[model samples]
Target: MSKNNKISALSEKDGVNKPEILSSQVAKHIQAFRKKEILATELIEKIIAGDKVALSRAITLIESTNNNHLEKANAVINGCLPFANKSVRIGITGVPGVGKSTFIEAFGKHLTGLGKKVAVLAIDPSSTLSHGSILGDKTRMEELVKDENAFIRPSASGESLGGVARKTREAIILCEACGFDTIIIETVGVGQSETAVHSMVDFFLLLKIAGAGDELQGIKRGIMEMADAVVINKADGDNIQKAKMAKVEFNRALHFFPPKSSGWQPKVTTCSAVTTDGIAAVYDLILEYISHTTTSGYFDAKREEQNQYWMLETINEQLKNSFYNHPEIIKQLELVKQQVLNHEISPFSGAQLLLEAFKKKT
Candidate 1:
């Protein structure tokens, strides 16, 4: 038969109808699941039981902007607090094209192989204008995503890293409560995200690439100072020598900075994500740092400090949200903004007017 006749046979009037790809029962179950309302107490119980689904739902609740969700999320977080802070929180960052995702995948696999439960909070960069994110972490870390011991959650870094940090910190608590012994927060390598991530993690790792021409320039930024360990990725092929050179340069620059409060010196190393070279050494280094900090009492002290920082950050976030969401403030903000733009009022005056209006409403 000709190609046209062969194709026509399948769609003939008397041909069998296509089978249902989705089962009716399964469809109904999905709909019911979507409509199911989980109480904060139930969520907390399930999360403590190490249910990944429940943990994800709780994080979603925390990220939601709905007032009801915010209240429920707070309740869940409070309930999970007793079980939190038990995990090692590590923050990983690097400039774009530094193979952060690839390295993280390899490192996560190594951790899982050692019988560690790892939860990665990968923050995808959001477009400033559109506020959309690629959220491709699962794609980039395909192996880790499939590993049963590793949970990878991609969150959008919307507008500012402050908001992302708040949500991520809460997510960390949830992840720990879910019995994840290791929590890795992967943030965008640029801007203020590093500072925000640095404040929340027990250890901060800065990823770099060999021959990227950023080693010296990066030294000028505070990221180098914040780094607990710097790992130059993609060290395979002929670039291995260059990576070694970069490591030496990083080490030399690190020595010029003041000693860390933790009394642990930062180390520079090189690794290859593809070949899995030097990956184990990186984990060993992190373990060594953790041991040193824990023995020196800096581990718990830093966590206490982070908790205080989180408290103040939460207050600021709440006040900012309340101000913008206040009915009076929202109503007057446009007019005040126009007045400022038209030179009828100074910028600070407009801000004061909004603040006063917000205060009155409160």
Candidate 2:
């Protein structure tokens, strides 16, 4: 047989385990990313110069769990920071059947038609059993996925609450560095994750549909309250009248909420992606909001607030990891759990003991 196969057979004959050999295809990619060969600073420069491949690789680096890759990723992000926060960040969320993908495809096309560069960072829910993402929603935006002026990335919601989305917020900075003017952060919209998306975006758009009946419309009021604007999708043909009525209802509903921090009233509008009607109105509304907020200085203030929030979030995350991953904490965690469960120690006492153990690591 072949030399490698013969060697394997000989190893088996000798009752020895053969060493794992890297596949040639995998070796090609491995060789391409050899350590220190391509500096992260070089990648950052290429990304700032609008190199698509470099941006993609930089994002991959950020998403990597490898310690070296993490260092490189942070370096690249820090380098890109000076050029970031230039783009308008929009957050979109809706029920599963609210036609979010279709709306984004049509809306993205509209923006690109106006000569705007767009980037869509969508969060996909991970499968609990497999711990993998089911990335079917992003594919639904086929046109946006193919647009040369657009970059679409689907990240798994695998990190802490809003953690993946926070990474997405970082990705927005990268996209802005690459000269993308518009950044849309789309959430899975199937869980409490909408709060995470709302916290990061400059403007939050809540997508809704008509004819779902009152008290059972599938969207929570807290979500509605969190929105800066509500857009009813699929407003075509038979649904046009229903959508118009829904818009009126939403406007009335929004009137009851307290004034927004931005001093801008939330709007309700109807749009039909299938017919491309009202898409321009939605875009125009975004511009209006941006102009109004910029004039009022709310835009800059909001971004600064987001930065402050992220700083605290990063601190909390790091502290938790440090506490939990401490060797003493890791060793005693099970014992504390058993003590609390068996009533040998109170829950607070058990926690304090663990914290004491974790403090010793310092």
Candidate 3:
């Protein structure tokens, strides 16, 4: 049969009248308009309106690994940038048994009672085997979990240094833009991660338990030096005396170090999260520090420095990602590794070869 005859017969069989391209295009446009793809502008508006669901969705976008979502995340952040950096960022670290979650529950409730909104960006330790969060912070922070003014997000740090999640700084910006006045970043109590957390926050807190050896608390002198405040938890019951002694020791240890760049001395305080005793005092100390630093212009300067540090860190991370993810590098990476193992090429030379290959491809 002729092609035109076949087409006409098939079109008639399908009950076709005019199968028009213009009609299909109009339908496509209507569908596109009806589909309602989420926009960066709409998300930003919902976030600024203090909608928690929108806030959570924005964080999820920021944490997403999909390249397509990366642009949207950046857009959300860029949109929110003007509203960010207005809040206090506090980094909290402690050994596993020091009741960190309990303390956070008490602290968050206390802050909300004062009409402050609190957001906790907690880094939970992931299993080396399964790579899942070991501690469920929401279950642990029972009271704060029920508070409308409190937001708790647990990020599993899978094989990351010091159990600090990769996207925590970005999460902080999201929370702040959504109008949370206080952001508490809770890191898994490994000593190495304190530097990572400290670099991102305005104040770094070291939470310690009484009667625990330096080894027990996993706190090194260097970590101690990084702390803006050393708060000894579990200060009630029969442990009060020991807590006091620990405070003195911490104060003495802090005295031996040179003063911080801000010239603000690190303080040692005792608190009982269970009893809520001295909890207010701990926050008072924080307020006092903020007041002194703000009056001295150190608070603003410190935050500005943090922003610069994060920018450089982000650049480094992106360079490493691009280097490893380039097609040319991926193809040769295994061969380069084998050569290094066989001593056929020096490690530095192998690295240079791969880097040159990547550069050429780019």
Candidate 4:
């Protein structure tokens, strides 16, 4: 069936007229956004305006696969951009039970108490595999989420690696547009591949447990090397000395590696996110790094580089989607897969045939 026919048939099966229904839904969202009734801009605007509800909804819209909602969602984001603050973007990762959520809640509350608008976006990797997210961070962040100045969003990874959600980059933009002065991205800490979060965030923070004698083994060199700051958590009570010792080891280890970006030294610090001790110092360290980088013009340059990376990623995603969506290409995929599996042809040759078939369809 033709694309239009397929859409029509799908719409019919769902008991609705496809084109008209989609158009109406899109129009309704647009109107709701503009009329101040729905406040599509306010969702993110509230986030920037220090409204938590707006922030949550804005994230939900961005993560939605509803094709009709995308255009207007993009529009709302664009409109909110001007009012948004150029906030500090921090990526936080650590092993499970390292009190990541607790640390964020305490840390977020600390920042907001200092009159900073904090936006928390948690990347829930478990959600991707299970197709359901507990949104545990928001629940764990009880006080912070309730604060009018704080916005908390928990997103499923959706087949992305290192617990980084696919729409996270766009979500960051929306959070920024909403005037969130501080944006924190929390990724599930499992593999060494947490570098994906490092690519987009300005500051990469690796949180580790105190007394994990084999600290080096816990965090891979690749991720440790990318870190802007290494934080030792659970620094209260008996763990305090261990945390301090871990800091010393990390600091020494960092000395052997060259700086990640020019003119900025990645520091190692200790904090008990549970007790809120040393959390403020962690924030201060980030500010110090940002100040030094901005003074050296490295901040602006890094953002430009990140923009280029996003452009490439967007192009790659679109091409993959378009190729797989083509009628002829879809029909040819199984045959190519079998041929490649059976070693009847080289993978490259199979790819070439698929490309040729796609070109013919066009």
Candidate 5:
């Protein structure tokens, strides 16, 4: 090839201007916002004023493991408490591939369209080996993420059991205080996490796909019992008929269970996330349950019970963290673990020894 005549394929040329994902105005705003350290009081004020950025920062503080952040995080949470509990908390769960992300987006968009502020706290499962998660729920919920009335936060499950983030309950308080009247907590799917999520949310929704053999599976008894609504998602097109069948089966299955304490019967519905079919009915169902419970005064009573449960849970959690983080326990845990593994000591005995050591450390 002649040097001048032959154009080099590898040579770089100025490409057409690529559109900025974030505009210059947004970039500058973000820069200006990040330049100053917001105090707890300012963060609480901003969050109460419905500033999404401040809400996010407060949530970050809540999720942080650093000791220095704990006090401020608590301060912000305490400040938010008076404004919290004004929202309806919904817990959603289903198996993988059940179109949870899609359903949540559709449901969230529906709520926002009604002028209700929505916040989605999505829990992404962490890898057992690397302890990392994709936290891609925000990306999946593109339209909802862009809605000014909606806030979507994807958090890693980390070592927390039950497919929920450790600080999810705290996050809920912050979301409610931030003026999000509808809080949707999406679990990591159906597991022990559902129990945690159930205790925290006012309404528990179980999302399922049609013909998944869930109709006959008694293994889901616990989750089914906890579910205030069993929604068959992906109920459009070819799956419509199957979804109807599943709904019937689920309704029958729900009959086998006793009535909920809230004096509300569980509902079975079918929806398609793609077409957004039957999404509004789900919200209506939630409202009905809320009204029914509120009228009976079970709503506030249940929240009080949950508060007590979480207070004890927090104590247990703090004790566990303190025991593990104690210098003496940290030094001996591995040795005791190795001894148990080598059969030099019984696991129960090793645990007792560790507890004793922790006691002395304290």
Candidate 6:
């Protein structure tokens, strides 16, 4: 058959259809399982049926930038809200050579051995600049990656703040929905701004190296203020004493910062990701933080605050997109830029004019 005939035949088989509804009401209904309007058992069955394509599609729905997808995503999150609180969210960050992947591999193995399921979502900042990610963490975490109780997802950060990916927060929700007890977000440990990860996770951990003296350069007040615990990697072998020294420095530094949301002092420890020494201590510290916060009601409060923050962020993102998509605003933006460049007005004035034009249109 000719190409036109083939297309016609397929179109006839499918019948005529209207453009898709941006709000995706059908998707919202599918996500209503969390409200008891749908069955949780059936949801779990769908997730665990080894349907890789379905899982990927579900993740895309949750990560979507479209306003309609946002509503559907919220419905899905609400449905899983009750079952989601059981998991512990931990944020782990460190410099390039601090062995974050190795530590997570060993730590995850330890957790699974204790009959717990672990989920690791690592965000590689380099992916944004290079448009490629090493994704080496999965290879380094060979054992954990293969374990049935473990799920490792390496995502491209793509210009996101704090070397954290955009969909990480949503991915955490999905992992909780799937019944994972531990969710670990690994971020590229650049410096101060990395605290964005702290806002999302329950426990915020900072990984350091022994005697990197670069600690003085990277350990700003902002990072220390958010950290719940600081771990010095490569503590085994000859690096042990140096790691101990680094831990002391970090401990002293922590004294100047205020307490974290959990109202507990962030502890400092040294560990060898290679030998897995002190990994259990790190896990123990996380549990202690969780216990303290939960008992004090801070855990619930923090989650509430996080939700509010997410809502505000969503609103800002949507407004920015809407402004750029507005035809009148786009036309005025070019004129405004030209005006500014010709020194006819300051950039701020040009922006004001654009805003005025936009408001008039709406």
Candidate of highest TM-score: 1
Against the true structure, what is each candidate's TM-score?
0.92, 0.87, 0.87, 0.82, 0.89, 0.80
Task: Give the winner by TM-score: 2 or 6.
Answer: 2
Q: Rate the local accuracy (lDDT) of all candidates.
A: 0.90, 0.83, 0.88, 0.80, 0.92, 0.78
lDDT per residue as tens, model 4, 3-117: 7555643353446554654577889988886665455655654655645556667777767766567676777677776765387889998888888899898888889889998
Q: Per-residue lDDT of 1-362 in model 2, one digit per residue for the tens?
A: 78755664335444677776988898888878675456988988999998888888787777765545667788899999998888889999987888888888899999999999998888887766686887775578887888889988888877547434447767887889998999988888875878878778888998988887741332446887788888999999999999999888888888887888889998989999889899999989999999999999999998888889878887886688678777888899999999999999999999999888777679
- Candidate 6 lDDT over 90-114, as tens digits, reads 9988778888899899999999999
Question: Mind giving the per-residue lDDT tens digits that candidate 5 earns over 211-290?
Answer: 88868773357999998999999999988999999898888888888788888899899998999999999999999999
Q: Please list the residue runs of candidate 6 whose C-alpha ends up more than 4 Å from where it truly belongs after superposition.
A: 1-45, 48-53, 66-72, 126-134, 215-220
Between candidates 2 and 5, which one is better according to lDDT? 5
Candidate 1 local lDDT, 184-276, one digit each (tens): 999877767888998899999999988888777755858888999999999999999999999999998898888999999999999999999
lDDT of 3 by residue, 1-362 (tens): 78755664335344558766578788989999767567899999999888888888888788776667878999999998899988888899888899899999999999999999999999988899987776599999989988999999988887667788878888888899899999999989887788999989888888999898762333346788798899999999899999998988888778878888888999999999999998999899899889999999999988888889989988987788788888899999999999999999999999999989999999
Where in model 2 is the C-alpha error above 4 Å?
1-37, 162-166, 214-221
> Candidate 3 versus the native: TM-score?
0.87
The superposed Cα distance between candidate 2 and the true structure at residue 349, in angstroms, equals 2.0
* Winner of 3 and 6 under TM-score: 3
Worst 10 residues of 4 by lDDT: 8-17
Give the C-alpha miss distance for residue 97 in model 6, angstroms. 1.1
Q: Over the full model, what C-alpha lDDT does candidate 6 score relative to the true structure?
A: 0.78
The TM-score of predicted model 1 comes to 0.92
Off by over 4 Å in 5: 1-37, 218-220
Worst 10 residues of 1 by lDDT: 157-166
Better of 5 and 6 by TM-score: 5
Clashing pairs in 1: none
Q: Which residue window of length 10 is worst by lDDT in model 2?
A: 212-221
